[model samples]
Target: MKTQKLTLTVVMVAILVVMAYIPAIPLGPVPLTIQNIGVMLAGAILGWRNGLLAIIIWLLMAALGLPVLTGGSGGIAPFFGATAGYIWAYPVAALFIGLSLQALTRFNRVNFVTILLTIIVFGVILIDLSGAVGLHITTNMPLPKALIFQLTFIPGDIVKSIVATILTLTLRQRFTALSHA
Candidate 1:
């Protein structure tokens, strides 16, 4: 069981890293990437503990100067850069998603509605808000402006969350070990 957990966690981390490397649109301090989908999946599938661990491990890899983040930009620079707020929020968001799913599962309500709501709340809104906050703090952007900027990410985030939800549900059916406990 431990080995399975470790293996699945590593796979999730790898998936997130690969997703990061997909083509990104540079948007000043915050570039748009699809990695958030994988992050949400990690939380919903791996649960809070392993999901958070996966994000932390991936962040550590980037901090260690590996080309594992968006646009091949790695190292500790991003952590302290304008993306810092979002970076800091990744594990927290993952943890929230995982915890939400675990609780939902306990109620036998791990269906589309619950999964979608959690992803929209914890995964989409939480991450985008954190990124906006980071951008505001790091770049001296006004708080309102930063928040408005986050609005532009909503459509994309919604789409990504939907994708993550489908993937989570599918994977959960096939791999009981990966489903939220």
Candidate 2:
């Protein structure tokens, strides 16, 4: 079962990485993507360790010259480029989202809706803000421009987060392992 789970996780992450690279819907600085769904799913389904590992694996593939990033751009260069911080933050974001869910489970009587809402809001805003800050520093953009770019991402990110939350809730109800209890 462990081997199967690991294999499934790897395949899912790989598919997500490819989805990340595809640029079908370009929207200024941020392209529409299913990548966040993968990120959220990784956390919600796989929990911290396995979730993070999946992201790392995807990133490693991208680093290894796979076009597993937006607009099919990938390489060591992108890893240090403008979007680097956001890309790097993915694993940590997933970790937090997953672990927070786990913590929520510990309470045993908490509101599921609240927990999911908090994860979406916190994960999207805080984590993406860190990426924007990195973009500001790395690209040397002014704070205002950076904020604009970050805002561009907000709409799409909110959509992704909500979708992720819904999907996570549904999957958790079906799959016992998602709770990791």
Candidate 3:
């Protein structure tokens, strides 16, 4: 049973890694991608540790030259490039997002959904803020412009959070083990 769970976790994370590569509408510097949804799903469905592990696996793959990032951005260059900080913050984001949901003691259906939504949005905002700082440092731009660039993702992030929350809640109800961490 543990092996089966591990296998399922691996498969789910792998799918998310692939989803990370799928490019979305590139609106300027901040390209809207499904990667955020993947991140949220990892936390929401897998809980904290396993969700973080999934992100770790994906990041390691990207670090190893897999083009798993948005817009085909990959290799070591990206790790040290403008988006580096945001990329680095991803695992942290996932971890916190997971914790925010699971830490809730109430643990009811509605509470779970509420916690998930709160955490997902919080994580997204953290990523956007971190990415904005990364852009400022990398491009040597003013803070105001960097903030504006970050705001471009607001719509997409909201959509991603909603979709991920819904999918995760449905999966949790359907698959009991998935909710067990």
Better of 2 and 3 by lDDT: 3
- Give each prediction's root-mean-square deviation over alpha carbons: 2.4, 3.0, 2.9
Clashes of each: 0, 1, 0
Using TM-score as the yardstick, the better of models 1 and 2 is 1
Enumerate residue pairs that collide in model 3.
Answer: none
* Off by more than 4 A, model 3: 105-113, 177-181
Local accuracy by lDDT, each model: 0.89, 0.72, 0.74
The best candidate by lDDT is: 1
The TM-score values for the models, in the order shown, are: 0.94, 0.84, 0.86
Q: What residue pairs clash in candidate 1, if any at all?
A: none
Q: How would you encode candidate 2's per-residue C-alpha lDDT over 90-118 as one tens digit per residue? A: 88877887787778778863255755675
Query: Model 2 — which ten-residue stretch has the worst lDDT?
Result: 109-118
Q: Tens digit of lDDT per residue, candidate 1, span 1-181? A: 4888899999999998888779988766687888888889889989999999999999999999988888877998898888898888889999999999999999899998899999999998998889888888888999899999998789999999998999999888988754455
Model 2 Cα shift for residue 88 (angstroms): 1.4
lDDT of 3 by residue, 49-136 (tens): 8878888888888888887777655678777777766787778887887777776634553454585566556558888888888878
Give candidate 2's error at residue 17 in angstroms.
2.5
